[model samples]
Target: DVKVTQSSRYLVKRTGEKVFLECVQDMDHENMFWYRQDPGLGLRLIYFSYDVKMKEKGDIPEGYSVSREKKERFSLILESASTNQTSMYLCASSLQGHEAFFGQGTRLTVV
Candidate 1:
């Protein structure tokens, strides 16, 4: 079974702080994605990587960045965290044209 692991289940940070959310997948998939979920906006992609050392910006890449230095690991960085950036962040991994396995998610609150 494929498993996605998130470093934290919840996070709290002060405004203007830098934050890092880490994720890892056991399935050795080539594609990994980072998304932020909000009430009305649903799941909005923040970034994705198809291969190690390669990354692409997704729909809502503003204020977000991603790194995929290893095949099974992907990291999301919030350059400068803010109150409006508070949301549930999800990490997912999958093969091309396949359904993704998602992590338990990290709920972030900025104060």
Candidate 2:
């Protein structure tokens, strides 16, 4: 089975602090995505990488950036964590379709 691993299950941070969330996938999938899932706003894409060293901005990339230095690893960096940025961050991998294999998720809380 394909597996995605997140660095942490929960994280708490103060406003204006930098945050880093890491994700690694075992599958050799071509696409890796970072999304923030809120109560009603649904999953908002933050960033995605189709290949190593190549990245693309998603729907909501203002407060976030991403890194894809290897085929199996991806990272999401919050330049400055804010209260509004507190949400469930999810990492996903897929070949091309809308269907994706998702990680358990990382719950981030910014105070």
Candidate 3:
């Protein structure tokens, strides 16, 4: 079974702080994605990479960046975290055009 692991399950940070969220996938999937989930707004894609060292910006990329130097790892960076940025972050991995396997998710709170 494919498994996606997140570095942390919960995090709390002060406003204007820098934050880093890491994700790793055991499967040799070619596609990896980072998404932020909010109550009513649903899941909004932040970034994605289809190949090692190749990345694409998703729907919401402001104040966020991603690194995919390795095939099985993807990292999301918040340049300067803010209160509005507090949300659940999800990492997913999948083969091209196939169903994606998601991590348990990391909940971030900015005060």
lDDT against the true structure, per candidate, is 0.95, 0.94, 0.96
List, residue by residue over 24-65, the lDDT tens digit for candidate 1.
Answer: 999989999999999998899999999999999999999988
- Alpha-carbon shift of residue 33 in model 1 (angstroms): 0.2
TM-score of candidate 1 on Cα atoms, chains taken together: 0.97
Measured on C-alpha atoms, candidate 2 has an lDDT of: 0.94
Candidate 2, 1-111: lDDT as tens digits: 889999999999999999999999998888999999999899999999998998999999998989999989999999999999999999998886757899999999999
Clashes of each: 0, 0, 0
TM-score of 2: 0.95
lDDT of 3 by residue, 13-105 (tens): 999898999999999999999999999999999999999999999999999999998999999999899999999999999999999999999
RMSD of 3: 0.7
C-alpha TM-scores of all predictions: 0.97, 0.95, 0.97
